[model samples]
Target chain A: MNETSRAVGWKPRGWDVLNIVLLSLLALATMYPFYYIFIYSISVPEEALKGVYLIPRGFSLQNYVHIFKQDNILWAFFISVARTVVGTVLTLLCCTAFSYGISKRNVPFRKLMYGAVIVTMYISPGLIPWYITMKSYGLQNNFLLYILPGLMVAFYIVLIKTYIEELPAALEESAMVDGASYYQMLFRIVLPLSIPVLATVAIFNAVNQWNSWVDNLYLASDLKLQTLQMLLYTYVNQQTAALSMINSNSTAQTAFVMTPTSVQMTITMIATLPILFVYPFLQRFFLKGLMLGAVKG
Target chain B: MEKTAPRKRKIEVPLLVLTVPFFLIVVLFSYVPLWGWSIAFVDYVPGRSILESAFAGFKYFHRLFDSTSDFGTVLRNTLVLSFLHLICSPLPVLLAIMITNLRSGRFAKFIQTVTSFPNFISWIIVYSVFFSFFSIDDGMLNKLLYGTLHWIKEPSNLLSDPRWTWWFMTLATVWKTVGWTAIIYIAAIAGIDQEQYQAAEVDGASRFKQAIHITIPGIMPTFTILLLLNIGNMLNVGFDQYYVFGNALVQEKIDVIDTYTYRVGLLNMDFSYSTAAGIFKSLVSVILLFTANFVTRRTSGRSIM
Candidate 1:
């Protein structure tokens, strides 16, 4: 490549080097805020604010201990875990079934159903009515509150439908001729053939469910049912234990020691870790699925 | 790609039947909730059915449009914030393109991963970082400024000051989301055929000029689609970030339709009035989407639909 570049009268420009340096610096700036929080989370809260540059004076697991001691942390983690798993499964099923049904160009009222999903995606009735409906239905305080509202996203359904549409028709027709039922064809052929896009939808739904917080804020009032992000918000912003510690002649050092910023960061890590763990495996599929939908005419 | 049986091709009733479950979910969660628009007309009460609520037809909506209300302030704030985002959001796309210019693929992806990390952190964490940088005490920014030229006694409370709050919010948004936003544009650039670039280079075109003439035009379709999509969702000034970062002092400047709905419906139990406001928001969003789609159709022969 270097010899070819030289032969072509191409020289690596200084402007390119400058641009690279500037972009790297900007990326660093974007990253430093989270990096700083991770640093603070481990430092005694007092040392955190006092420009604890690069190293923790006294690193401790005390903050994590404090977070766990709150009685609801472990429960919230489980609820979040269960919610992500259950919600993703249910969503995948609903979306896939609907997508499969709709993908058949000859299905009765297919366009109408497709139109219904697309309209809903483009026009949400906003959160107020959705909240009202959930409350009126008495889904609040129920574990189903976390799972039910999340299922059957239109975009995922459409993506899956598009992917199914691309499959060779002969494969499905041959199966149909060989004494296979519709369900049998879908299960044995369509699904296995559509694994890549299915995994793509699964990852997208899982990450969305795991990261969601706004719905729970309005619906789930039970302390035990609180998800990880909600719990983190309550602790970091509203909790008086750390605030009271900060006041009442407590030194800056003491305030720093008490605030569980480290644990909070860890909580963030925990909440997002599942998605991060799954991402590497699904990265190629995700990129493929994304491009397939995004770039198609 | 799939072929069907040629003998009077039949619609699969069983397969169509499978749609019932999904239809039920959509109707229950989506279509049924359209009835909640009536909440705007009534003094909605908890425990009472929506039908039983006291009727106050268009009263809340009137109040929303009333100049006496801070509806104008909020409307103005929403517009300005979104406009600023519209203008400044493209900076990261340029940044991403610059990074992509680096021949080293590993270096580019590393920069991308690092920049995109903040998108995963909750706004609460971002708020904490803001305090560290802008708090009235020994904030890093203030420390640096003071040491360079002893300006003041304390770090300026950028979070509390309304003048600075919008900038703070904008910066926070840019820092967290810009990287993720740029990923699509970067992908768009990557989708460009390299043959054009080679042709331009053979014509003795500089990298910069070639980028302007060939690279940009190649990705213009993606740009048009993204621009249309963004304009359609302009009203969605994400409630999460603003709510987490907002304080009482800056609420006037930062309060959006979503936050206002939360306060009115969830906090005060003015369900009908809040529902009315929400309905108005949805209507506006639908109008925007249609208008944007129409514009795109006319200009580029492409529509989101």
Candidate 2:
């Protein structure tokens, strides 16, 4: 294991060094920000204000503790979780129904119906019109505001429809010959075969529903109804003056002091971790979904 | 074509039953909003039907062009930010190339995964990371620059400064999606025939030369397709980042079309004025899509359609 023998087998040590160094730098660039924020969240106020707090200064769970203790945060988390689950399921259901019907090559005016969905992909009716329409539907300040308008995404419908189109028609033909109705075939045959794509689309919808803030910003104004993303948005934008009220807790004297920065970092981590944790499980399906688009498109 | 096959109209009954709800919903949600664009033509007020509203054609359109609407500034902000994003679009291609060039397989994979992780988190969370790094007076960057490096006298308000908004927002967006965006290019690279690289190796081609001659050209079609799509979406920059980032001090630089529409239409209840702006934006987007399609067809002999 001499240096000269090691050098003999490898062709370009310089290139390897450059490659490793550059990639290492890039890795750090992408990763260090998360590390920095985590350190800041856990760092004591005095140490955070002081020199180079790379590691946690005092090792405190108080910031995270304070975050869950607040009523606003608890309610916001529940709303976000509920909406994400509900919105994603409804969206998948709507997309599956529409795409399943249209994917049938024999359906009359199928192209026209598919064209209708595609046209909306390129042309939004414009934001003001959209807002007015949503308000007109009496969704303003309602929980349905988060779920109803997004139930049928044209793009996802197109993707699912394309996936369904690729399935062997013989499966449907045999099922039909057995006197299976369209509903029975779709649920029993099409959906079971299309699970990979369905999972991918579901992941996309769930992540989107959880992450969405703009709809909440416009449609849900009641303090009681704001989702976690909206709460995070409000905190980030410094629009809410109610943050100071959290500090008024009597346990503040007994506990490590909680700052807005600490609470925000904790909230951001809480909102972010669920998606990040689930991402590895979904990445394979997600990449497969990407292939579904790429191969057909 | 399949005329000999059984025409099962009965199956369609259930299929149509399943699909009809979505169709009606789309008509209500999407088509109704498109019809709302007509508000730009009239002095729309609450409680009055659009037909009953006076037929004041282009009145709000006129306001859009006039200084009263501040439309010029909004257009400038939107176009400038989008243009910046367009210019930086090639960075993803560069990143893909760099990753492919790396000799260490595990290291390259790790970098790809770490970079794409940012894309999973929404922009609001991105803002928190950004705030931690750049919030004025006490921010990490300020602490390093002023306290440690003696770079400047005053701690600049980097977040709210008009001068920094475009670059900052673009960096924020690019930072989040660059690696994720690079995935398509990586796929393009993978799709390139391995035999070509083996042939090049036998011809005594260097790695750099191989990348130049084989890898870059291999992904050209994907590059062009993405470029055309980007051009088609030139006017469709959404309001999330700008809405979250814009402040009173930097309002002039960051008040893009979406944000301006939200403010005027919803906040001020100036429905007619905002609808006019929305109409203008949509018209530009439609024209750009057509133009992009035409140009792509002319050059590459392919169109998005």
Q: Which candidate ranks first by lDDT, i.e. highest?
A: 2
lDDT of 2 by residue, A194-232 (tens): 887788889998898889888888878898898898888
lDDT of candidate 2 at residue A4, scale 0 to 100: 41
- Candidate 2 lDDT at A113 equals 75
What DockQ, on C-alphas, does every prediction get? Answer: 0.42, 0.50
Worst 10 residues of 1 chain A by lDDT: A247-256
Instruction: Report, to 2 decimal places, the DockQ of model 2.
Output: 0.50
lDDT (Cα, tens digit) per residue for candidate 1, span B41-72: 88777778778877888899998888787667
For each candidate, give the interface RMSD after superposing the true interface residues on Cα.
5.3, 5.1
Best by DockQ: 2
Compose the digit string of candidate 2's lDDT tens values, residues B1-305: 12356656534566677777788888888787898998899989966788899888888888888866599999999999889998998889888988988877887888888888888888788888888778884577788887888798978777988888899889998888898889879888999999999998766666666888999899998888888888888767888888877789999999999999999988999988898999999898889889988988888887775
